[model samples]
Target: MTVSRRAGLLSAFLLPSVLTATTATGAALAQEGKPREVVSTISSGYFDDYLMLAVDGKAKTLSGYYNDGKCRFIFRDALSPTELYQRSELGEAYVVDSWDPDHPDRHFTTTLYSKTPNGYRNQLTLEPGSRDENRPKACRNRISLDRSSWVSESFYDVAVVRKRGARVFTIARAGEKPTPAPRKDRLPPPGTGVWIDRTYSAAFSPKGFVRLNWYDPPGTPHGGYVRQEDLYPSQPLPQRDGGDEAVQ
Candidate 1:
């Protein structure tokens, strides 16, 4: 479905990437005992903009796209630790909190590791909400991997639209458009209750414009199984958590 270019629907809804909480010190590594609240607020550069891909409500996720070596991530539209239990579209929650307050609050985390020559090679893990009892059983036995690729594009501005009903939106930039490649033999399993392996590529133009490209094999009922993911690029990691600045 084509989206409206109206600033309200497109720009307002483009969930801006920003810092969640705040870190005690701007200059320090995230260690135990004194973990800082990972804030992901927008900056002056591309890290300031963020985009959202809505799929039948419940803000799936949010984040900042890669622009320079200083890759920053933003996580907005947080679902209270309990909201995960009451869902509508994105199937059942696979990652849930262990209920232990001391832990990482059982939310989504954006981890960036050493990128290899082939695909993304970082270990990013997110635990479902504590009340998410409907998580897939396999989630207990093994970890569910929903991997996506990153490009030097500008997918930072996420446009939000408050529709009266649920709508499925495939969030992708102009270049990194969305594609269909799900199903029995497809790369990412596009189905509910199953771990869908997504392949997200990116692109950019000489004008310094960047966007995201996603592959959701199971699209909507009009075409595929429908509904999935809320994008988040401004997720916190070892870098770009607090407002720490480093010389490039």
Candidate 2:
């Protein structure tokens, strides 16, 4: 699809009210410690292309490419911890959630993952709105994978602090001054490990900054932006003496 068409489809998927409602639902699910469901949609198109879906069961993630011969888009979703128990199913199954970039607040959970003879597959029932206007009101399809694969590693870059007292900010724009990260979202002590999503790192590269997320001693995740200069490419290991030693 053309870029303009893709943008229009995404815009139509989520109205302001729908976005607010779904975003609230996602937040509630997180607060309740409930497993998150995963879903995906193509907006509008014939289901003839080679739609590939790969699952990393261990990580509870699903990722794949959607190709319609003309255009291709990549999607990945984190699956819920809860499993679906069905009488005829073998192995495990979990709920999946998917969202569009234009309407991040809106999420769908109409897809399901199941173990198959070859490996794993996802069976998805397309949402009414996601289908072409002239197509059937109900649509379903399956995408299978022969093996599980790690997808997160490809999307993030790992780094560690280069010096003590380095700071992270909540936002870092190309031309605007950055806003300091809140106390709760501050970077951990120097030499601690942190990671920045490739998407954010690349987007803010013009500003010489990268957003980083790290875990405090308690294992809680905190994130903020930091200047690229404050980080080193390698993560150092903590030595017995409380200092960090470069990895060989």
Error of 2 at 99 (Å): 2.7
Q: How far is candidate 2 from the true structure (C-alpha RMSD, Å)?
A: 24.8
Predicted structure 1: clash tally? 46
lDDT of candidate 1 vs native?
0.26
Question: Local distance difference test, per candidate?
Answer: 0.26, 0.43
- Stretches off by above 4 angstroms in model 2 are 1-65, 69-81, 101-106, 121-141, 144-248
User: What 10-residue stretch in candidate 2 is worst by lDDT?
Assistant: 40-49
Candidate 2 per-residue C-alpha lDDT over 1-248 given as tens digits, one digit per residue, 9 for 90 to 100:
99999999888886777989999999988887853342422111112223434444444455433433332233344533333434224333433333322233444433444454432322332221233232222223344323222223432334546667776666534456444433443456644545555443444454666766554653355666677777653212212343212111
lDDT of 1 by residue, 108-145 (tens): 33222112222122222233222344332223322223
- After superposing candidate 1, which stretches have Cα over 4 Å from the reference? 1-76, 79-121, 129-131, 141-148, 156-212, 215-248
